[model samples]
Every structure is written in C-alpha cells, then in structure tokens.
Target: MSELRDTELSAKVKGIEVTVTFPLAHGKPFHAKQAPETTVGTVRSEAMSQFGIQEEANSTYYLTHGGSRVDDGATLASIAGESEAVKFTLVKELVQG
Candidate 1:
C-alpha cells in the first residue's frame, strides 16, 4: 500500500534591479545607471547565473505587467509596464472542493 502527494509550482520575483557596470575607454573604472532592457525571463536568467543555478525545467515565476498580474502563460516579451524596479508577490493555493 502506498499514498500519493500533490504539489504545484509558483513564485514571485520582487525588488528587481539591473545594475550595469563599465569602464572608460581609457581603462578607467566607471559605472552607469540604466534599466534593464531585456525581458523578465532574461532577468531571471541573469539572476540564476549570478547565483550559479542551472536551468531546471520544473521552476517558474509569476509576473506582472502594467498592473496586470498573471501566474501562467506569460513571458517577459509580453510585459507592457515601464522599465523600473517592479515588485511582485506570488500566491498559490490548492483548488477547493
């Protein structure tokens, strides 16, 4: 005899800030400020890379675009919000009977 378990995937990425660093043509240490021009997916990839997390097929994150928040079937390419440090909170619950 055995039992079964249930589980789901969901997440929210908040406090997103893309920092760009560069040096002058003269090889001087310098820096610049600019918002990330890439998609949220790319941002996730960047974060994962920063943390040395390999690509896993069982991981996902919730997203909000222009006040429209969705948990599934959305991509960074479709985000319509202005470029800024956007915050998001993810919520998940089991279907009620």
Candidate 2:
C-alpha cells in the first residue's frame, strides 16, 4: 500500500495501514488500519493472532521494518512517517547463549 492520497480512513484518525508477513508462517500478510498512536506491540499481538501463532517455549516474535528490528514501543505513525502504509516482516528469534 502507498500513501492515502486523500483517501481518508476516518475523520478523527489519519489512519496508517500496516501489513505484516511471516516467511515461515505459511499464511498471507496481516493487514490493519492503525491509528497514529497505535503501538508496535499491539500490532504484533494482532499479527500473531491472525497467523494463529502460539507462544513457543524458547522463541520470541519480533517485527522488522526496512530490514531493521523495530522496538515494540514504537508507534506506527513513527514508522510510516509521512507515508500512510508500512510493511513489516515477523521474524522468529530463538534464544541463544
């Protein structure tokens, strides 16, 4: 997805849409219209649900945007910046000593 281009999602929210994909999940990308203040953690949880992922014993799920790990506390607005759409890839990180 690209910038809204005058396509208003909501009057109160200049919404930015987020799409998340997992290479190993064997599923389609998860898409959502996110408010500016929505947190990455919240999106991660939603993505997990969409992908039917359950908590694993030693694996952690993280999101990467532009090939960089994104902090859970980061807001979608921050990631999108002047754009209205952002894409993320969900990665499974195994705990390693």
Tens digits of lDDT, candidate 2, 3-94: 36222323334888899999988768999998877889999999999999977888999999999999998777667776778999999999
lDDT of 2 at 91: 93
Error of model 1, residue 21, in angstroms: 20
Instruction: Please name the candidate that would achieve the greatest lDDT relative to the true structure.
Output: 2
lDDT of 1 by residue, 1-97 (tens): 0111100111232223443212211232222222333344555444444444464455443334444554343333233233334443322223434
* Cα TM-score per model: 0.32, 0.83
* Superposed Cα deviation of residue 87, candidate 1 (Å): 3.3
lDDT of 2 at 55: 75
Pairs of residues at least 3 apart in sequence or in different chains that clash in candidate 1: none
Best by TM-score: 2
Q: Go through the candidates in order and give the clash count of each.
A: 0, 0
